[model samples]
Target: MNPTPTYRDVATVGIGGPVGSGKTSLLSELVPRLREEGLEVGVIANDILTQEDANRLRERFAGVVPEDLVAGVETGACPHTGIREDPSMNLQQIDAFLAEYPGLDLVLVESGGDNLAATFNPELADYWLYVISVAEGDDIPRKRGPGVVDCDLLVINKTDLAPYVGADLEVMTRDAREVRDGPFVLTNCKAIDGIEAVHEHIVEGVLFA
Candidate 1:
C-alpha cells in the first residue's frame, strides 16, 4: 500500500520580514485570490507570545478559509526559532492540517516580525518570501541580509509611504537588484498595488512549478 501522505505532500510557502513589514496584509490579499482560483490554502502565523496576527487573519479569511485551517503558533522565543532554527512546532501544525485537509493545495506560514536575518528552514517551506518596508529605509536591501538575499522573492512593501518617509524607491530598487539574483516586487498593501505580481510569483514558484 502507498504510505500515508504528510505535510510534504502539500506545497508550503514562508513569508518572513521585519516588524510591521505588512506580511499579514499581503496574506489578506493573497488568500482570497488563491481561494477564488479554487485552491485550498492554509495559513499559520507565528508570534512570540500572542496570537494577534493569527486571530486577525482568521477574521479576514472568515468566509474564504475554514477557521480550523488558520492557526497560530506561539514560539515562546524569537520568531526564527519556530520557523527556522527548530521548526518542529510549525511542522506539527502542518501535519495536523494535512490530517484534516489532505487535498490542501498550499500553506502559507508567516513568521512573527523579525530582523532581516530571518529565513525559513528548507524542510519547512518549499518557497519563501522576504518582505521589507520602504519606510524602513532604502538601505535595507543594500544591507544584503540573508532574508533579503536568499528568499525566493523579495517583497518591498509600503511603497506609498516612500515619499513621506523620505525613502527613495529608486535606490531600493537598484539595491535589491544588486543583492538578489531573484525577482522583487514593490507593493502598497493598503491600495493593493503590485499584488498581482506577488501572486503570480507564488503561483509559479510553488503552486504550478
Candidate 2:
C-alpha cells in the first residue's frame, strides 16, 4: 500500500520533449526565476534508467529548488510508457512531494526528453508544455505528433541556433500555430532570450486564471 500523501498548494505542470531539446536546462533556468518571484516550485523527473535528471537538477538548482522537491522514476526502458502509459510511479512521487512541502505552489513534472511521440497524462498536470528544438529540424512542427498538437503550450527552444542550423524560425512557428491551435513560443534558453514571455504566459494562462 502507498504511504499517506503529503498535501501542498502545488499546481502541477508537465514538461516534455525530445532528447537534447533542453528540458532540464529550461528547468535549471525556471526554478530560480520562480523562486525569485516567490512561487514555491517542486519537480519530478522521470527517467528511463536512473535518477540522472533528478540529480542533475539538484546539483544545478543548488539552493533554489529544494533537494527533496525533485524525485526520479525508473521507467525500465520505456520512458513514454512510464509517464503516459503507466504513471503510477509518477503519482507516488508527486504525492510524496505534496506530503513534504505542503505550501508548494507548483510542481513541474518533467518527462525524460525522449521523442516527438511523448506527452503527459492530463491526470498529471493542470497544464503541460511540450518542448521542441529548432536544431531538431523545421519539419518537426509539421509532423503533428500528439505532443505538438495536444500540449497546452508548445515551446520551440534553441532558437539561438536557428541560423547556424538552417532552421526556419518563422515557418516552424507558423506550422506549430497551425497545428496546436494554441500559443506557440520561441525561446533561446541558452541565451536566456524570450523566457520572460514564457513566464508571463504561465502566470496568465495557468498561475492566475
Candidate 3:
C-alpha cells in the first residue's frame, strides 16, 4: 500500500561537462569512495546512442556496486535535452532504481559528453556538478558558460595536464571565482587528487543536507 517513489524521493546528483572533460574519470573515483562510506549508490550515464560510458562505469565499479544499479539512457538527441529540456528519461531511471532498491542512498547521473551549455533540470538532479578540463583551454572559465555558472559545484579537472597544455591554473582559478558564486574544486582524477573534496561537496550538498 506504499506510494511509488519518485525521483525527488531520492537524492540525485547530475554530472555534466564537455566531451573529454574527465566526467567519467571523476565518477570512477567518487563512486568507490562513496561506497567506502557505506552508502548504497546507483549511477545513470546518458548517451546519444551508446552505453559506452555506462559500461565503463560498471566495469570500474564492479566489486563496489551492483551491476543492476548502473544504467545507460540513450537520449538519441542532444545531450542536454535528456537532462535539461526534457528529463523524463532520467526521472524514469531514478524511479526504477528506487523500486528495486528502496534504500539506495544516492544516484549519480552523468550526462553524455556535451558542450559548455549543458545543464541538468532541477527536477532531475537535487544537486549538480559541471566539469571542465584544463586540456580544453584556460579560457573556458572566462567564457562563462551556463554549466559553469549555474551548477552547484564547478570541477576544474586535469590539473596534471595544465602544465603540458599551457593552461594556467591561476587564471582558471581567478576566472572560476569571478563567474560562479558556488564553490569549484581543482581535480586531477587520474591521481585521485581533489576527489575527496568533490565527494565532500556532494555529501554536504545532497546527502547530509
- The residue-by-residue lDDT of candidate 2 on 33-126, one tens digit each, is 8899998888888888888888988898788777888778888877787678877778778778777777778888888867788888766677
Task: Give all TM-scores, in the order shown.
Answer: 0.97, 0.93, 0.97
lDDT of each: 0.95, 0.83, 0.94
Name the regions of candidate 1 deviating beyond 4 angstroms: 1-5
Q: Against the correct fold, how does model 3 do in TM-score? A: 0.97
Task: Report RMSD for candidate 3.
Answer: 2.0
Per-model root-mean-square deviation over C-alphas: 2.1, 2.0, 2.0
Tens digits of lDDT, candidate 1, 1-209 = 85543878889999999999999999999999999999999999999999999999999999889999999999999899999999989988999999999999999999999998999999999999999999898899999999999999999999999989999999999999999899999999899999999999999999889
By lDDT, the best candidate is 1
> Which ranges in model 2 have alpha carbons more than 4 Å from their true place?
1-9
Instruction: Give the clash total for candidate 3.
Output: 0
Alpha-carbon shift of residue 47 in model 3 (angstroms): 0.2
- The residue pairs found clashing in candidate 2 are 6-98, 6-99
Candidate numbers sorted by TM-score from highest down: 1, 3, 2
